[model samples]
Target: MFVRIVKMGFQPDKIDAFFENFEANKNQIRNFEGCLFLELYRDKNNTNQFFTYSYWEDEAALENYRKSDLFLKVWGETKVWFNQKPEAWSVDKVVSLE
Candidate 1:
């Protein structure tokens, strides 16, 4: 499995709108091919900071999703609210307690 993490910092006033847009597109993103799991997280001390954690079957699968229309539509709108460039990482599991 491939794990993808994206950390984003949004303009303070745009946080709520960003979450609303994310919520609206969540299902569509989660349903994409090879998307095993998807989740959103908020920084404990920073309301305008968020992270997206997702699992895919592999890099190619993730790439396919990234290139899909669903991603284009969501990302196109989401980028407008960012206060800074988002950070992303793709990793493979080394160990899992569960």
Candidate 2:
């Protein structure tokens, strides 16, 4: 499984808009091919910081979603709300915990 974690920093003033966009697009993103799981997280101390955690069948599947129109539309709207550049990680599980 391929895991993806994206940390995003939003402008405090733009937070509401950011969530509105997320609410509007999250399902479509989750429904994309090879997407196995999707979850959203917010910082405990810093409300403006958020993270997207998801699982894909593989890197290619993640890449395919990145290339899709949903990503373009979502990202285009999302970046404008950022206080800083987002950071992303693609990882593989090395240990099992279940």
On lDDT, the candidate that comes out on top is: 2
Of the candidates shown, which would achieve the greatest TM-score relative to the real structure?
1
The CA lDDT at 66 in model 1 is 86
**TM-scores, each model vs. reference:** 0.96, 0.95
Candidate 2: worst-modelled 10 consecutive residues by lDDT: 89-98
Residues 75-94, candidate 2: write the lDDT tens digits: 99999889998999998878
Model 1, residue 69: C-alpha shift (Å): 0.8
Model 1, position 85: C-alpha lDDT score: 97
lDDT of 2: 0.93
Query: Global lDDT of each model?
Result: 0.92, 0.93
